[model samples]
Target: MAFNYEQYLRPGKLPHIWCPGCGHGIVLKGLLRAMDACHLDKDRTAVVSGIGCASRLPGYVDFNTLHTAHGRAAAFATGIKLARPEMTVLVVGGDGDGVAIGGNHFIHACRRNIDMTYVLCNNYIYGMTGGQFSPCTPMGDKASTTPYGNPDPTFDIAKLAIGAGATFVARTTAFHATQIDKLIAEGIRHKGMSVIEVLDDCPTAFGRRNKFRSVVEMMKRFKETAVPAATAAKMSAEELQGKIVTGILHREERPEYCEQYQQVIDRARGA
Candidate 1:
Protein backbone atom coordinates (compact mmCIF):
# COMPACT_ATOMS: atom_id res chain seq x y z
CA MET A 1 0.00 0.00 0.00
CA ALA A 2 1.15 3.49 -0.84
CA PHE A 3 1.87 5.57 2.24
CA ASN A 4 -0.20 8.76 2.36
CA TYR A 5 2.04 11.72 3.25
CA GLU A 6 -0.67 14.40 2.93
CA GLN A 7 -2.01 13.64 6.41
CA TYR A 8 1.29 14.72 7.95
CA LEU A 9 1.66 17.84 5.83
CA ARG A 10 -0.01 21.24 6.13
CA PRO A 11 -2.38 22.38 3.41
CA GLY A 12 -0.95 24.89 0.90
CA LYS A 13 2.60 24.23 2.13
CA LEU A 14 3.48 22.64 -1.15
CA PRO A 15 6.07 24.03 -3.56
CA HIS A 16 8.83 23.89 -0.95
CA ILE A 17 11.54 26.47 -1.36
CA TRP A 18 14.31 23.94 -2.01
CA CYS A 19 16.07 24.17 -5.36
CA PRO A 20 15.15 21.66 -7.99
CA GLY A 21 17.08 18.33 -7.65
CA CYS A 22 18.05 19.15 -4.07
CA GLY A 23 18.07 16.16 -1.72
CA HIS A 24 16.29 17.95 1.16
CA GLY A 25 12.95 16.87 -0.25
CA ILE A 26 14.08 13.25 -0.20
CA VAL A 27 15.06 13.60 3.43
CA LEU A 28 11.66 15.16 4.18
CA LYS A 29 9.82 12.18 2.78
CA GLY A 30 11.99 9.83 4.79
CA LEU A 31 11.26 11.84 7.93
CA LEU A 32 7.53 11.63 7.37
CA ARG A 33 7.78 7.89 6.89
CA ALA A 34 9.75 7.57 10.10
CA MET A 35 7.16 9.63 11.95
CA ASP A 36 4.46 7.28 10.74
CA ALA A 37 6.49 4.20 11.64
CA CYS A 38 6.93 5.52 15.16
CA HIS A 39 3.24 6.38 15.37
CA LEU A 40 4.06 9.91 16.42
CA ASP A 41 1.05 11.91 17.50
CA LYS A 42 0.95 15.27 15.77
CA ASP A 43 -0.29 16.88 18.99
CA ARG A 44 2.43 15.40 21.21
CA THR A 45 5.35 15.62 18.80
CA ALA A 46 7.31 18.83 18.33
CA VAL A 47 9.60 19.43 15.35
CA VAL A 48 12.05 22.28 15.75
CA SER A 49 14.60 23.67 13.32
CA GLY A 50 17.21 26.41 13.07
CA ILE A 51 17.55 28.66 10.01
CA GLY A 52 18.63 26.75 6.90
CA CYS A 53 17.17 25.00 3.90
CA ALA A 54 16.56 21.94 6.05
CA SER A 55 15.05 24.12 8.77
CA ARG A 56 12.23 25.00 6.44
CA LEU A 57 10.95 21.45 6.86
CA PRO A 58 8.89 22.03 10.01
CA GLY A 59 6.81 24.70 8.30
CA TYR A 60 5.34 22.07 6.00
CA VAL A 61 4.81 19.37 8.55
CA ASP A 62 1.49 19.28 10.40
CA PHE A 63 2.80 19.12 13.94
CA ASN A 64 3.89 21.26 16.83
CA THR A 65 6.71 22.93 14.93
CA LEU A 66 9.14 25.73 15.71
CA HIS A 67 11.21 27.57 13.13
CA THR A 68 13.70 29.07 15.49
CA ALA A 69 16.68 31.39 15.00
CA HIS A 70 19.80 30.38 13.15
CA GLY A 71 21.86 27.64 14.83
CA ARG A 72 19.59 27.46 17.90
CA ALA A 73 17.44 24.43 17.20
CA ALA A 74 19.11 22.23 19.77
CA ALA A 75 18.83 24.89 22.48
CA PHE A 76 15.15 25.48 21.73
CA ALA A 77 14.41 21.78 21.56
CA THR A 78 16.19 21.23 24.86
CA GLY A 79 13.93 23.74 26.55
CA ILE A 80 10.84 22.16 25.03
CA LYS A 81 11.93 18.71 26.19
CA LEU A 82 12.65 19.88 29.71
CA ALA A 83 9.30 21.63 30.04
CA ARG A 84 7.16 18.93 28.47
CA PRO A 85 9.00 15.74 29.24
CA GLU A 86 6.19 13.76 27.67
CA MET A 87 6.53 15.39 24.29
CA THR A 88 8.66 13.82 21.57
CA VAL A 89 11.02 16.54 20.39
CA LEU A 90 12.87 16.42 17.08
CA VAL A 91 15.42 18.89 15.73
CA VAL A 92 16.30 19.36 12.08
CA GLY A 93 18.96 21.56 10.51
CA GLY A 94 21.81 21.65 8.01
CA ASP A 95 25.52 21.01 8.55
CA GLY A 96 26.28 24.70 9.11
CA ASP A 97 23.37 25.14 11.51
CA GLY A 98 24.12 21.98 13.51
CA VAL A 99 27.91 22.02 13.82
CA ALA A 100 29.11 25.52 13.07
CA ILE A 101 27.23 28.12 15.12
CA GLY A 102 25.15 25.54 17.02
CA GLY A 103 28.04 23.14 17.73
CA ASN A 104 28.18 24.00 21.43
CA HIS A 105 24.46 23.61 21.97
CA PHE A 106 24.50 20.32 20.08
CA ILE A 107 27.38 18.84 22.11
CA HIS A 108 25.89 19.95 25.43
CA ALA A 109 22.56 18.35 24.58
CA CYS A 110 24.42 15.14 23.82
CA ARG A 111 26.46 15.35 27.03
CA ARG A 112 23.24 15.83 28.99
CA ASN A 113 21.70 12.86 27.19
CA ILE A 114 18.48 14.73 26.68
CA ASP A 115 15.53 12.80 25.27
CA MET A 116 15.30 14.25 21.76
CA THR A 117 16.26 13.40 18.22
CA TYR A 118 18.38 15.63 16.01
CA VAL A 119 18.31 14.99 12.29
CA LEU A 120 21.23 16.83 10.71
CA CYS A 121 21.16 17.23 6.96
CA ASN A 122 24.76 17.49 5.81
CA ASN A 123 24.75 18.90 2.29
CA TYR A 124 28.41 20.00 2.69
CA ILE A 125 27.73 23.67 1.90
CA TYR A 126 25.54 26.51 3.09
CA GLY A 127 22.97 26.11 0.34
CA MET A 128 20.33 28.62 1.41
CA THR A 129 22.60 31.42 2.53
CA GLY A 130 25.41 31.22 -0.03
CA GLY A 131 27.64 28.45 -1.29
CA GLN A 132 29.93 28.80 1.68
CA PHE A 133 32.00 25.91 2.91
CA SER A 134 30.64 24.28 6.07
CA PRO A 135 32.40 22.31 8.79
CA CYS A 136 31.56 19.09 6.98
CA THR A 137 32.58 20.23 3.53
CA PRO A 138 35.34 18.07 2.15
CA MET A 139 38.77 19.61 2.04
CA GLY A 140 39.49 21.01 -1.45
CA ASP A 141 35.79 21.29 -2.28
CA LYS A 142 34.87 24.49 -4.04
CA ALA A 143 32.42 26.87 -2.34
CA SER A 144 31.57 30.51 -2.90
CA THR A 145 33.68 31.45 0.11
CA THR A 146 36.41 28.97 -0.75
CA PRO A 147 36.82 29.34 -4.50
CA TYR A 148 40.50 28.53 -4.11
CA GLY A 149 39.35 25.18 -2.61
CA ASN A 150 38.58 24.44 1.05
CA PRO A 151 41.79 24.04 3.02
CA ASP A 152 40.28 23.11 6.41
CA PRO A 153 39.65 19.56 7.50
CA THR A 154 36.10 18.30 7.46
CA PHE A 155 34.22 17.12 10.53
CA ASP A 156 33.19 13.51 10.94
CA ILE A 157 29.66 14.14 12.24
CA ALA A 158 28.87 10.63 13.47
CA LYS A 159 32.15 10.37 15.33
CA LEU A 160 31.62 13.84 16.77
CA ALA A 161 28.16 12.89 18.01
CA ILE A 162 29.49 9.67 19.55
CA GLY A 163 32.36 11.55 21.20
CA ALA A 164 30.03 14.24 22.52
CA GLY A 165 27.99 11.59 24.39
CA ALA A 166 25.01 11.10 22.12
CA THR A 167 23.51 7.80 23.24
CA PHE A 168 22.29 7.00 19.77
CA VAL A 169 24.15 7.95 16.59
CA ALA A 170 23.29 6.85 13.09
CA ARG A 171 24.15 7.92 9.53
CA THR A 172 22.79 7.41 6.04
CA THR A 173 22.76 9.18 2.71
CA ALA A 174 19.81 10.49 0.72
CA PHE A 175 20.69 7.95 -1.95
CA HIS A 176 19.82 5.21 0.49
CA ALA A 177 16.22 6.28 0.76
CA THR A 178 14.98 3.12 2.50
CA GLN A 179 17.69 3.31 5.13
CA ILE A 180 16.93 6.93 5.98
CA ASP A 181 13.52 6.22 7.56
CA LYS A 182 14.74 3.05 9.26
CA LEU A 183 17.61 4.87 10.96
CA ILE A 184 15.37 7.83 11.86
CA ALA A 185 12.75 5.51 13.34
CA GLU A 186 15.43 3.87 15.44
CA GLY A 187 16.69 7.24 16.61
CA ILE A 188 13.17 8.37 17.54
CA ARG A 189 12.69 5.20 19.56
CA HIS A 190 15.94 5.64 21.48
CA LYS A 191 15.71 7.11 24.97
CA GLY A 192 18.67 9.43 25.17
CA MET A 193 20.01 12.07 22.77
CA SER A 194 19.89 10.69 19.24
CA VAL A 195 21.65 12.19 16.22
CA ILE A 196 20.93 10.98 12.73
CA GLU A 197 23.14 12.49 10.06
CA VAL A 198 21.69 12.43 6.58
CA LEU A 199 24.26 13.08 3.86
CA ASP A 200 22.25 15.08 1.34
CA ASP A 201 23.10 16.99 -1.82
CA CYS A 202 22.86 20.69 -2.65
CA PRO A 203 22.91 20.56 -6.41
CA THR A 204 22.53 24.27 -6.98
CA ALA A 205 25.07 25.40 -4.42
CA PHE A 206 27.56 22.70 -3.50
CA GLY A 207 27.30 20.53 -6.58
CA ARG A 208 27.64 23.18 -9.23
CA ARG A 209 30.63 24.65 -7.46
CA ASN A 210 32.19 21.20 -7.10
CA LYS A 211 31.63 20.28 -10.77
CA PHE A 212 28.78 17.81 -10.31
CA ARG A 213 26.87 17.90 -13.59
CA SER A 214 23.53 16.80 -12.22
CA VAL A 215 21.73 15.61 -9.10
CA VAL A 216 22.12 12.03 -10.27
CA GLU A 217 25.88 12.47 -10.39
CA MET A 218 25.87 13.74 -6.82
CA MET A 219 23.70 10.82 -5.70
CA LYS A 220 25.96 8.39 -7.51
CA ARG A 221 28.87 9.54 -5.41
CA PHE A 222 26.92 8.72 -2.25
CA LYS A 223 26.01 5.27 -3.53
CA GLU A 224 29.60 4.55 -4.44
CA THR A 225 31.10 5.72 -1.16
CA ALA A 226 28.61 4.54 1.48
CA VAL A 227 29.44 1.39 3.42
CA PRO A 228 27.29 -0.37 5.99
CA ALA A 229 28.63 -0.45 9.54
CA ALA A 230 28.69 -4.24 9.65
CA THR A 231 30.61 -4.33 6.39
CA ALA A 232 32.93 -1.61 7.60
CA ALA A 233 33.83 -3.70 10.65
CA LYS A 234 35.38 -6.30 8.39
CA MET A 235 37.35 -3.76 6.35
CA SER A 236 40.79 -2.40 7.21
CA ALA A 237 41.41 1.27 7.98
CA GLU A 238 42.96 1.81 4.57
CA GLU A 239 39.94 0.22 2.87
CA LEU A 240 37.55 2.47 4.77
CA GLN A 241 39.28 5.69 3.81
CA GLY A 242 36.83 8.22 2.35
CA LYS A 243 34.00 5.78 2.86
CA ILE A 244 30.79 7.03 4.46
CA VAL A 245 29.95 4.38 7.03
CA THR A 246 26.18 4.13 7.21
CA GLY A 247 23.84 2.50 9.78
CA ILE A 248 23.72 2.75 13.57
CA LEU A 249 27.27 3.61 14.56
CA HIS A 250 26.80 3.92 18.31
CA ARG A 251 24.13 3.45 21.04
CA GLU A 252 24.14 3.20 24.83
CA GLU A 253 21.82 3.55 27.79
CA ARG A 254 22.20 6.63 29.94
CA PRO A 255 20.35 8.62 32.60
CA GLU A 256 18.16 11.02 30.67
CA TYR A 257 18.55 14.69 31.69
CA CYS A 258 14.86 15.32 32.44
CA GLU A 259 14.65 12.32 34.79
CA GLN A 260 17.72 13.51 36.67
CA TYR A 261 16.33 17.04 36.89
CA GLN A 262 13.11 15.63 38.31
CA GLN A 263 15.10 13.93 41.06
CA VAL A 264 16.72 17.26 41.87
CA ILE A 265 13.29 18.86 42.21
CA ASP A 266 12.15 16.09 44.49
CA ARG A 267 15.24 16.50 46.68
CA ALA A 268 14.67 20.25 46.85
CA ARG A 269 11.12 19.67 48.04
CA GLY A 270 12.36 17.28 50.72
CA ALA A 271 14.98 19.77 51.86
Candidate 2:
Protein backbone atom coordinates (compact mmCIF):
# COMPACT_ATOMS: atom_id res chain seq x y z
CA MET A 1 0.00 0.00 0.00
CA ALA A 2 1.29 3.43 -0.87
CA PHE A 3 1.69 5.75 2.11
CA ASN A 4 -0.23 8.87 1.13
CA TYR A 5 1.70 12.03 2.00
CA GLU A 6 -1.13 14.18 0.64
CA GLN A 7 -2.62 14.88 4.10
CA TYR A 8 0.74 16.04 5.51
CA LEU A 9 1.92 17.63 2.27
CA ARG A 10 0.35 20.89 1.30
CA PRO A 11 -1.62 20.95 -1.93
CA GLY A 12 0.15 22.55 -4.97
CA LYS A 13 3.47 21.72 -3.34
CA LEU A 14 3.96 18.51 -5.23
CA PRO A 15 7.09 17.86 -7.26
CA HIS A 16 9.38 19.22 -4.60
CA ILE A 17 12.35 21.22 -5.95
CA TRP A 18 15.03 19.14 -4.27
CA CYS A 19 17.67 17.59 -6.56
CA PRO A 20 16.99 14.12 -7.99
CA GLY A 21 19.27 12.25 -5.61
CA CYS A 22 18.84 14.63 -2.70
CA GLY A 23 17.80 12.86 0.53
CA HIS A 24 15.60 15.66 1.94
CA GLY A 25 12.52 14.08 0.42
CA ILE A 26 13.37 10.77 2.03
CA VAL A 27 13.79 12.47 5.40
CA LEU A 28 10.47 14.28 4.92
CA LYS A 29 8.75 11.01 4.21
CA GLY A 30 10.20 9.53 7.38
CA LEU A 31 9.07 12.57 9.36
CA LEU A 32 5.55 12.25 7.99
CA ARG A 33 5.45 8.60 8.99
CA ALA A 34 6.64 9.51 12.46
CA MET A 35 3.95 12.16 12.74
CA ASP A 36 1.35 9.65 11.67
CA ALA A 37 2.57 7.08 14.18
CA CYS A 38 2.48 9.67 16.95
CA HIS A 39 -1.03 10.69 15.85
CA LEU A 40 -0.08 14.29 16.41
CA ASP A 41 -2.70 16.90 15.58
CA LYS A 42 -1.45 18.87 12.59
CA ASP A 43 -3.42 21.89 13.73
CA ARG A 44 -1.53 21.92 17.05
CA THR A 45 1.87 21.30 15.47
CA ALA A 46 4.25 23.97 14.19
CA VAL A 47 7.02 23.22 11.72
CA VAL A 48 9.79 25.77 11.49
CA SER A 49 12.87 26.05 9.30
CA GLY A 50 15.71 28.45 8.52
CA ILE A 51 17.20 29.56 5.19
CA GLY A 52 18.62 26.64 3.17
CA CYS A 53 17.54 24.08 0.58
CA ALA A 54 16.47 21.83 3.44
CA SER A 55 14.73 24.76 5.13
CA ARG A 56 12.10 24.73 2.39
CA LEU A 57 10.41 21.87 4.29
CA PRO A 58 7.93 24.05 6.22
CA GLY A 59 6.38 25.36 2.98
CA TYR A 60 5.55 21.85 1.81
CA VAL A 61 4.00 20.68 5.08
CA ASP A 62 0.40 21.36 6.08
CA PHE A 63 0.74 22.82 9.54
CA ASN A 64 1.32 26.05 11.42
CA THR A 65 4.68 26.74 9.80
CA LEU A 66 7.37 29.38 9.55
CA HIS A 67 10.20 30.07 7.11
CA THR A 68 12.51 32.06 9.32
CA ALA A 69 15.86 33.87 8.88
CA HIS A 70 19.10 32.03 8.16
CA GLY A 71 20.36 29.91 11.09
CA ARG A 72 17.58 31.10 13.37
CA ALA A 73 15.09 28.25 13.30
CA ALA A 74 15.88 27.27 16.89
CA ALA A 75 15.45 30.82 18.12
CA PHE A 76 12.13 31.19 16.29
CA ALA A 77 10.89 27.82 17.46
CA THR A 78 11.89 28.67 21.01
CA GLY A 79 9.78 31.84 20.92
CA ILE A 80 6.82 29.97 19.44
CA LYS A 81 6.94 27.21 22.03
CA LEU A 82 7.27 29.65 24.93
CA ALA A 83 4.39 31.85 23.76
CA ARG A 84 2.20 28.84 23.00
CA PRO A 85 3.37 26.10 25.32
CA GLU A 86 0.52 23.79 24.36
CA MET A 87 1.63 23.49 20.76
CA THR A 88 4.02 20.82 19.50
CA VAL A 89 6.94 22.54 17.79
CA LEU A 90 9.44 21.01 15.43
CA VAL A 91 12.54 22.75 14.01
CA VAL A 92 13.93 21.50 10.71
CA GLY A 93 17.05 22.76 8.89
CA GLY A 94 20.37 21.76 7.36
CA ASP A 95 23.76 21.38 9.06
CA GLY A 96 24.99 24.89 8.20
CA ASP A 97 21.78 26.57 9.26
CA GLY A 98 21.61 24.71 12.57
CA VAL A 99 25.26 24.20 13.51
CA ALA A 100 27.43 26.81 11.77
CA ILE A 101 25.35 29.98 11.43
CA GLY A 102 22.88 29.03 14.17
CA GLY A 103 25.32 27.34 16.52
CA ASN A 104 24.75 29.59 19.52
CA HIS A 105 20.96 29.35 19.37
CA PHE A 106 21.16 25.59 19.04
CA ILE A 107 23.30 25.25 22.18
CA HIS A 108 21.13 27.65 24.20
CA ALA A 109 17.96 25.85 23.19
CA CYS A 110 19.43 22.54 24.32
CA ARG A 111 20.75 24.05 27.54
CA ARG A 112 17.31 25.43 28.35
CA ASN A 113 15.74 22.04 27.69
CA ILE A 114 12.97 23.58 25.62
CA ASP A 115 9.97 21.42 24.83
CA MET A 116 10.71 21.02 21.11
CA THR A 117 12.12 18.66 18.52
CA TYR A 118 15.05 19.51 16.23
CA VAL A 119 15.53 17.64 12.96
CA LEU A 120 18.99 18.35 11.57
CA CYS A 121 19.48 17.11 8.00
CA ASN A 122 23.24 16.87 7.74
CA ASN A 123 24.37 16.48 4.13
CA TYR A 124 27.91 17.55 5.14
CA ILE A 125 27.93 20.50 2.68
CA TYR A 126 25.85 23.66 2.41
CA GLY A 127 23.52 22.52 -0.36
CA MET A 128 21.52 25.73 -0.72
CA THR A 129 24.44 28.22 -0.79
CA GLY A 130 26.60 26.00 -2.99
CA GLY A 131 28.83 23.25 -1.60
CA GLN A 132 30.70 24.86 1.25
CA PHE A 133 32.17 22.74 4.00
CA SER A 134 29.77 22.76 6.97
CA PRO A 135 30.52 22.08 10.65
CA CYS A 136 29.41 18.47 10.18
CA THR A 137 31.53 18.04 7.05
CA PRO A 138 34.18 15.38 7.69
CA MET A 139 37.74 16.48 8.50
CA GLY A 140 39.19 15.54 5.10
CA ASP A 141 36.05 15.91 2.99
CA LYS A 142 36.14 18.18 -0.05
CA ALA A 143 33.56 20.84 -0.78
CA SER A 144 33.46 23.69 -3.30
CA THR A 145 35.31 25.91 -0.84
CA THR A 146 37.51 23.06 0.31
CA PRO A 147 38.66 21.83 -3.09
CA TYR A 148 41.77 20.19 -1.72
CA GLY A 149 40.50 19.06 1.72
CA ASN A 150 38.86 20.43 4.87
CA PRO A 151 41.53 21.37 7.40
CA ASP A 152 39.35 21.57 10.54
CA PRO A 153 37.70 18.68 12.35
CA THR A 154 33.97 18.04 12.03
CA PHE A 155 31.31 18.43 14.72
CA ASP A 156 29.64 15.35 16.20
CA ILE A 157 26.04 16.55 16.36
CA ALA A 158 24.72 13.78 18.61
CA LYS A 159 27.52 14.33 21.13
CA LEU A 160 27.04 18.07 20.99
CA ALA A 161 23.31 17.78 21.63
CA ILE A 162 23.81 15.32 24.48
CA GLY A 163 26.48 17.54 26.04
CA ALA A 164 24.35 20.66 25.62
CA GLY A 165 21.49 19.03 27.61
CA ALA A 166 19.08 17.65 25.03
CA THR A 167 16.66 15.33 26.82
CA PHE A 168 16.62 13.02 23.86
CA VAL A 169 19.35 12.54 21.24
CA ALA A 170 19.33 10.16 18.28
CA ARG A 171 21.34 9.63 15.09
CA THR A 172 20.14 7.99 11.90
CA THR A 173 20.80 8.01 8.16
CA ALA A 174 18.42 8.61 5.24
CA PHE A 175 18.94 5.04 4.11
CA HIS A 176 17.73 3.75 7.49
CA ALA A 177 14.13 4.65 6.76
CA THR A 178 12.53 2.66 9.59
CA GLN A 179 15.03 3.79 12.19
CA ILE A 180 14.70 7.40 11.11
CA ASP A 181 10.94 7.30 11.49
CA LYS A 182 11.16 5.61 14.89
CA LEU A 183 13.67 8.16 16.19
CA ILE A 184 11.58 11.10 15.01
CA ALA A 185 8.49 9.63 16.64
CA GLU A 186 10.40 9.13 19.87
CA GLY A 187 11.75 12.67 19.73
CA ILE A 188 8.26 14.07 19.27
CA ARG A 189 6.98 12.07 22.24
CA HIS A 190 9.70 13.36 24.55
CA LYS A 191 8.87 16.37 26.78
CA GLY A 192 12.07 18.40 26.66
CA MET A 193 14.50 19.30 23.89
CA SER A 194 15.11 16.46 21.40
CA VAL A 195 17.69 16.38 18.61
CA ILE A 196 17.75 13.90 15.75
CA GLU A 197 20.73 14.22 13.41
CA VAL A 198 19.80 12.73 10.05
CA LEU A 199 22.74 11.93 7.80
CA ASP A 200 21.56 12.70 4.26
CA ASP A 201 22.94 12.79 0.70
CA CYS A 202 23.78 15.97 -1.21
CA PRO A 203 24.52 14.38 -4.57
CA THR A 204 24.97 17.51 -6.58
CA ALA A 205 27.17 19.77 -4.48
CA PHE A 206 28.84 17.42 -2.01
CA GLY A 207 28.79 14.12 -3.90
CA ARG A 208 30.14 15.34 -7.25
CA ARG A 209 33.21 17.06 -5.88
CA ASN A 210 33.87 14.57 -3.07
CA LYS A 211 34.31 11.60 -5.45
CA PHE A 212 31.32 9.66 -4.08
CA ARG A 213 30.85 8.26 -7.61
CA SER A 214 27.06 8.01 -7.24
CA VAL A 215 24.25 8.35 -4.72
CA VAL A 216 24.29 4.59 -4.16
CA GLU A 217 28.00 4.73 -3.41
CA MET A 218 27.47 7.44 -0.80
CA MET A 219 24.60 5.50 0.82
CA LYS A 220 26.74 2.40 0.77
CA ARG A 221 29.45 4.34 2.54
CA PHE A 222 26.97 5.38 5.24
CA LYS A 223 25.79 1.82 5.72
CA GLU A 224 29.37 0.65 5.92
CA THR A 225 30.33 3.27 8.46
CA ALA A 226 27.21 3.07 10.66
CA VAL A 227 27.00 0.69 13.62
CA PRO A 228 24.37 0.15 16.31
CA ALA A 229 25.18 1.31 19.85
CA ALA A 230 24.99 -2.22 21.24
CA THR A 231 27.43 -3.43 18.59
CA ALA A 232 29.65 -0.39 18.98
CA ALA A 233 29.99 -0.96 22.72
CA LYS A 234 31.77 -4.24 22.10
CA MET A 235 34.28 -2.61 19.76
CA SER A 236 37.34 -0.75 21.00
CA ALA A 237 37.88 2.97 20.34
CA GLU A 238 40.41 2.07 17.67
CA GLU A 239 37.95 -0.35 16.06
CA LEU A 240 35.06 2.16 16.13
CA GLN A 241 37.28 5.15 15.25
CA GLY A 242 35.62 6.33 12.02
CA LYS A 243 32.16 4.72 12.27
CA ILE A 244 28.83 6.56 12.41
CA VAL A 245 26.96 5.71 15.62
CA THR A 246 23.27 5.26 14.88
CA GLY A 247 20.30 4.92 17.31
CA ILE A 248 19.24 6.73 20.48
CA LEU A 249 22.53 7.86 22.02
CA HIS A 250 20.82 9.33 25.09
CA ARG A 251 17.33 9.91 26.52
CA GLU A 252 16.27 11.20 29.98
CA GLU A 253 13.74 13.38 31.70
CA ARG A 254 14.42 17.09 32.17
CA PRO A 255 12.54 20.19 33.37
CA GLU A 256 11.29 22.23 30.42
CA TYR A 257 12.34 25.89 30.34
CA CYS A 258 8.85 27.26 29.87
CA GLU A 259 7.50 25.44 32.90
CA GLN A 260 10.43 26.60 35.02
CA TYR A 261 9.94 30.19 33.90
CA GLN A 262 6.22 30.01 34.65
CA GLN A 263 7.01 28.79 38.14
CA VAL A 264 9.34 31.75 38.70
CA ILE A 265 6.63 34.13 37.54
CA ASP A 266 4.06 32.51 39.86
CA ARG A 267 6.47 32.77 42.82
CA ALA A 268 7.16 36.44 42.08
CA ARG A 269 3.40 37.15 41.98
CA GLY A 270 2.92 35.34 45.34
CA ALA A 271 5.76 37.36 46.93
* Best model per lDDT: 1
- lDDT tens digits by residue: candidate 1, 189-256: 99999999999999999998898999999999999999999999999999999899999999999999
Worst 10 residues of 2 by lDDT: 139-148
TM-score of 2: 0.98
Residue-wise C-alpha lDDT for candidate 2, range 1-271, written one tens digit per residue: 8888898999998788799989999899999999999898999999999989899999999999999999999999999999999999999999999999999999999999999999999999899878999998888889888888999788999889999999999999988878989999999999999999999999999999888899999899888999998898899999998898899999999899999989998999995
Which regions in candidate 2 have their CA more than 4 angstroms from the true location?
Answer: none
- Show where candidate 1 strays beyond 4 Å: none
Backbone-clash count (model 2):
0
- lDDT of all predictions, in order shown? 0.96, 0.93
Alpha carbon lDDT of residue 163, candidate 2?
92
